[model samples]
Target: MSKALDHDPDHWPRRLVAVTPVLPMLPILIVCALVLVGLVDGSGVTWVPLLATAPALAATTGGPRGVLCVGLLSAVLGVSLGIRGDAADGVLAVALASLLVVTLACAATSALRGRRERVLAAVRSVAEAAQQALLQPIPATVGPFQVAVRYSAAAAEARIGGDLYALVSTPHGVRLIVGDVRGKGLPAVGTAALVLGVFREAAHDEPDLLDVVARIERSLARNLGTDDFVTAVVAGYPRDGQLEVVNCGHAPPLLVRDSVVVPVEPVRPAPPLGLRTLSGETPDLQVLPFADGDQLLLYTDGVTEARNHDREFYPLAEGLARHTGDEPVDTVTALHGELLAHVGGRLHDDAALLLLRMPARTEAPAPREPSGTVRVESCSP
Candidate 1:
């Protein structure tokens, strides 16, 4: 997900170009109205004088090229009218000058447009670089599992936001975190960074997933402001096939097996990290079967809360059911595409998806007989 930069006042040049195409036409329109009135009043062809406004109008509106075209056409019309009215060389000089002015103005406007486009290009490049550095990609393999993560911020330009996901292999086990901060911009990012940093360190030191959660809550309470909190799910995978998940006011993870989507039941969800004091009891760690070929999908509320043009919330379970399959990466890609399509293009909040799959475990070998004792007896015989 990427953050959008604040609006720039330096875009005046581009704005001028955008409005230039219309401003020059006003004078020609008024002159044309006067010409039509003169013709309707039975006056001599005094309307021919209005032809002089055409080139300047075109130049101001369409720039130099437009002016040139309008000038040439106006000159042709003026010469025809002058022949009929027997006008002098002075009128012809004025018509030629108008054409020249239109051409020059178009050239100048085109140059300004080119310069503005270049500047915009440079600004966009810098923004892209910043986004890349801020939201570096997670590797495909983390700990003992195959991991794939996809993230999209509602703002197309931003590469990250309040929604965050991270997987790290620690001495205790492989720990993962997915959470959504309450707001956006630097404040939200700062909170997310704080939570992730604490989670990574605590995951290694704290053997229990609940302890890790508590560590994160304490960290956030100290760093964040009064109302700020994070909705998060922290999970740990020991060497065994079972996964320990602790939900702190976060969306339940979806377990996919044989293309079936099932929401992992939380033992007891606690309040968001900073709001732990509101709850009487601490969150219990829920154990879920995580055999090989099974995938756990973690995401933020942005995906679940996405609404269509009709104001209907997207059915994420149904969408997942339709797209779930063997390949974790392909499944996520399809779901992400569907998500964007569901909302008609981009999302309004940060949406993140982390898919972790455990490969099928190899069968244990059968126990061997006591061959050493039999070999010794045979050798003695």
Candidate 2:
């Protein structure tokens, strides 16, 4: 029989609960010990009320039924302790009141925990909706290329990160962007939203790729903080066998031709968007041949900066060369898995990867003859 899968995501919590499977009755044992010691000491019924520890512990690890059982056990033993010690009426009353209070507090704790969990589930739903809005999913194929996108946020609870990516087919061609904002959480997300909003509108309207970038810069300048900026790579496929790229202080893109990968570093580096005043330089557009069977990888610095236990960074280019091949989806999936393994299955930063590969060419058709008949036919006929 095949081994059962523990990391099936859907059963993450279930699996952990199953693995430990400890009884939640340890609190009962603790209360029994305390009561025994109190009885051993003559008339020292003061420790009886400390049996409250039972309910408190039970509330954490036990369900409502289990908590009730523990609470009843604590009360019964506490009352027995008061009677055994021949305690005064006041002492007995105080002990009974203390146990009652503990039981009530346990009930309240369980109720609040359940309420918080419900609220957390609702918050998770909202986060998923917001993520879909911020990063519109990329299709598996666009234009003459196969495409794939892999994204992971550092904050596991957030489920979405500052990294942003989008691919849209426009009159200009298949234009896409991958970027990282300077900060994290909602503010970074807002900046990403601003960039994608402007990029989408600009990509469709502006034929020149650089013009699209300018629109985004202007949007960020108007809305973003003085210290905030986004590092991005904007790319387009305006025609077969050609690519247009603009880098805004982001990590260099990787290009794979014939299985040899190389970084396409910017020829003229410029400051990230929203800091154009510091550099006073418009980003340079790079035009290169993207022949058949070539692949382009766009990513954020998270891929490069991810460190292993020894503090060594993951080798992105080498890893791509090893994992990537003909299919963009398979390549990216394998590379992403490897990336997670390299970081011990959790990333400390938001990482994103977009792979685009032009499919191999099919045979060309034979040339067609001219429409008009030849003026002079060959001799004979």
- What lDDT does the true structure give each of the candidates? 0.69, 0.79
Question: What lDDT tens digits, residue by residue, belong to model 1 across residues 1-381?
Answer: 112111222143458778776776665565456545654553423555465566545544454565565556555554555555555667656655664565466557655766776798887687566445444456666665766667766654444578877787888889999999999986887788788878878888998888899999888877878789899999999768889899888999998887788998676757888987666557888888788778899999988998889988888888878877655565676776677667766477888888887766662322322111000000000
Model 2, span 150-200: residue lDDT tens: 777776567777889888899999999999999998999889898999999
Candidate 2 lDDT (Cα, 0 to 1): 0.79
Model 2 misplaced regions, further than 4 Å: 1-15, 19-51, 62-69, 77-95, 362-381
Candidate 1, after superposition: displacement of residue 126 in Å? 5.1
Candidate 1 residue runs with Cα over 4 Å from true position: 1-134, 278-281, 362-381
Top-lDDT candidate index? 2
If candidate 1 were superposed on the true structure by all CA atoms, what would the RMSD be?
A: 15.6
- Once all C-alphas are superposed, what RMSD does model 2 give against the true structure? 13.5
TM-score, candidate number 2: 0.81
Model 1 scores worst on lDDT over the 10 consecutive residues at 372-381
Model 2 / residue 247 / CA error / Å: 0.9
